[model samples]
Target chain A: MSQLKLNTEGMKPIYVQIAEWLETEILSASIKSDEKIYSQYQLAEMFNINPATAAKGLNILADEKILYKKRGLGMFVSPKAKESIQEKRKNQILKNLVLELVTEAGRLGVDENELISMIKTSNKFVGGRDHERN
Target chain B: MNVIESRGLTKTYGNLKAVNNLSFDIEENKVTGLIGRNGAGKTTLLKLIAGFLHKTSGEIEVFSDNPFNSIKVSSNMIFIDDKMSFPASLHLVDILEAAGNFYDNWDAGLANGLIDYFNLNPRQPHSSLSKGMKSAFNMIIGLSARCPLTIYDEPTTGMDVAVRKDFYRALLKDYLQNPRTIIISSHLLNEVEHVLEDILLLREGQKCMHMPVEELKELAICLKGKAGIIQELATGKEIYHKENIGKDSAYVVVKNDFTEDRLQNVKLSGVEITPVATDELCVFLTSRNKGGIDDVFDRN
Candidate 1:
């Protein structure tokens, strides 16, 4: 958490970044299901941000069911949290990046076939063959 | 509960109105940033709230009582600035001890810990420390006092970069542990914006804008592209700033009220959109001219 450096210049707000970072942490299995997450105060202290902003981020996850709140206790990761986060990132984040990629490819006069082949070749180069088979 | 409230609050010095017809309510347990340019009446307004200065007209309240020399307001509020001073004969440690006597919430342990952490010589007089060290020492007292209504008017005046960062973090941590209504007036909003829940922006002794920090961040957006297309899209919108990039290109900052579809179409049309930073937005909002300093140098 101490190594988390948010990009203050980007279009995304700090709370959104914090939410995404927490999702990534869960997806990476660093925080297991039903594990307690950092409180707003803890996140605020770690990020040097307003506690309200940090709480907003925690609320975002709570709303999405990626995290749940226990009475008198802090937020904890929900069961299947990683799977839900992956599903969300796939639909929102990955889709947006692919949209931008396709738009730029079109502007560069790269046809659909060429773009598809380029993606496959790049994937292979990055050792994605095992995932590809899966 | 409102810790401070003002109604048409005005203060005058000779013919100049330092704070003019300002009305606002500062809620309890929130960190609000009071931002403005130099001589923007930040200090004057803060002094009025701290009971150090009287209002010439209208009304100002601290804890529902008139703040002008009121004992209740004076006892509950602590105002820290770069010019904070102590008696010439009092040593650094004695000054801290004296400050503890004034505020009921003072944490002597925290004060002593901070004094030792900053490596200040307890035996030395307050005036003998370097400029940066003096500011650090003053900040220690301000934080340890833990007054309900704490006002810091450019409290980081002489501190170096590292000390400034440490002070901001410490302030935030303390505020979280003990909720209080805190107002910090500063010129360095970029560094302190993250710690603030609300911002009260002043321009020429008047309230330019006061809103939550999140809303202020989204108040404006910048567009850069062909000047003709930019002008076409910017029509009927409030454009706060404009600058020509090249002969054919232009950059304009306008209100961020456009709908998602409109922004997508504008991007599809090749106009690049960018978020305006809080500090930049403040500058643009308070700027006298749309062209800024470039207008002064432009002979055309």
Candidate 2:
């Protein structure tokens, strides 16, 4: 029952937003394994999208094995969806952050080693014990 | 995925065939532009897809199912026309309330925000709003409803350039936040050309061309220069449209290879060569008394 809101002012497609929202819900374990998620029609009516558009988002999840259809019933959250979703989301975020850092470094004439040093210095200044060193 | 599939889709109004055996597939997660002249049957085809009109003969599939009277299918699709008429006496807020009830995904916050952005007073009667305001109201519903497949027919008809640009900007912004299959039917081709992933060109109710924007760009080029030089360089080539202004002549459209070396040669020959805009290309393609299709293909 995650309240997935759409920003008509943004440039992303509604389907992608819906997919991201569903992924977030799955990762948070808000939608449990084998839970009967809303059907494409229901989702469409709920979101004011054409059912086909909603189906596209659902299909993306289904393709990733995060959701599965029960045939004549409805789509359900996959048993391993939460774990898979978490792994996928984490990898995606890291990749995006790395890309951003690389791009910024290119712009600012800074190297990866400098970035790594900055991270270490910042961690030290936070005054947290180095658990990695132990 | 093929959200909409049509085969030999034809529509006739007495002697005029608005859509003549049209066939095209609207894919998922892409913005498809429906472009045509005033009587080009763009609206007819859209209405046909929306199940508001029955086709004379042919097949149309929405989500692997016929869209006509299919509650599940139709419920997912929303069609916002240019002339969105609410009751004459109904207040703007009342109309929005009705819209919310009609659309399950209607975002009241988004609607209210849009109303404020447009400076529309909710207490104003629907009949009292200007043409531009009415269009804005319809646009708000189309965007805020978040419908998966939303078809907008001439959404910016009477608006000023500034307002039209605002609508496009808002549309792009909304699109980034929520991706859906949006079909925008408009005569203002130059305005919406960039926003479209693909374009459907209709002429006399027939699909004249259905292709990606990049492909279409590659297919046509504009050549301009001194009349004599341009004519010499364009010899034996298919000219889509040509205009001569005194000593300087410009062909707004032509079919040419447009390769770097070839284009350089044309330029060196004192002819200016550039790619034709989608709008200019459409006008050129649909112009009556133009050469045959083979003539267009022979330019290579």
Candidate 3:
């Protein structure tokens, strides 16, 4: 997948948006492991961002072992990049949802029991008939 | 080992000291932004480095050799000025051919691709193109030439917003592909601020400030609060600039060592702080009337 379109008007830096896009593509299997990624120049051209900004995003992926470079060749997705990204995404979502639920509960002056019940009800709706089997 | 280095570099044209005692080192493989007001000697500095003009005093070195009429050193550097001239009778194809022979690392494919992308007709005479189109053609050469030390002095003069944006994008893209020392001098301050890694600000033909963008941002703050409280807080400190609207006042300055508790006790209704931008910083620095290097340094 190409780099996600960035909202220049947004307060967040464009590089952060680029990193998020790459992570999403990796988790969704749109960019498979061992697939060749666009060079920094191509990415900069496509996004209209400074190469330094593009390089910073790619460096983040490299740090996560999502992408690796071959000397004189080009950058490619790591062999286990998909699995790694998936695991990371799962953890991130869980952490974010928990934080959101706690914050919402506190704001509404609801206790832990009330929050757990709300979660159970939502899970039932989401799981559908599978809730009965569980 | 300096790609470009100058010591007490001064250039004077009759009564006007176009460049004054400026000294800086431009390291290899890094992009530096040359910025200043219209008569701030940015063009003069570029010309000196490109060896198009002789300096009045001091020294300049490019790749450990003087660039004045030295073909070996000059070939490695390309200066694309706003008033860049070519033979009016020559065709665009001939210009490209000449540039290809001039630079050792010229990429014909990139030049051809850019020519097509910009919709430039190679068969057209050099003088026949519109001013904006001519600027675009110059940009094509700057990008595709692949010079190690490329300097652009207001290379986007007559281009519209869209075309200018395209040029910036192409510049960034090409720089990433081939990392080198590039200096861009332009008056469109805000547009180029994001792409610039470092800024060399000049005023009245003098180097006022040189710092990395992030570092410079950290040093400046825009503070708004009660006029009385702001005066008290700003007392015995350097106030670069200030604005007042009745009871409300705002002060811009380099970040100082002031405690929040002290400011809180001032009983101001509110205090809003934000980072000062490069352009704002330049205006503040150059707005002073003193005509000396010390005055410039003091303001900065």
Instruction: Identify the leading candidate in terms of lDDT.
Output: 1
Q: How high a TM-score does candidate 3 get? A: 0.72
lDDT values of the candidates? 0.90, 0.79, 0.79
lDDT by residue (tens digit), candidate 1, A1-134: 45357889988889998998899889888999999998999889888899989999999999999999999999999998998998998998898789778888988999999999999999887777677777
Candidate 1: stretches off by over 4 Å: A1-3, A128-134
iRMSD of prediction 3: 5.4
lDDT value, residue B218 of candidate 2: 61
- For candidate 1, lDDT tens digit of each residue in B73-143? 98999999988868989999889888888999999999988898889999999988999998999899899
Q: Count the backbone clashes (under 3 Å) in each candidate.
A: 0, 23, 0
Taking candidate 1, what TM-score does its chain B reach relative to the real chain B? 0.98
Cα misplacement distance, residue A82 of candidate 3 (Å)? 15
TM-score of each: 0.95, 0.65, 0.72
Off by over 4 Å in 2: A1-134, B226-229, B243-252, B291-300
Give candidate 1's error at residue B60 in angstroms. Answer: 1.4
Model 3: clashing residue pairs? Answer: none
Best by TM-score: 1
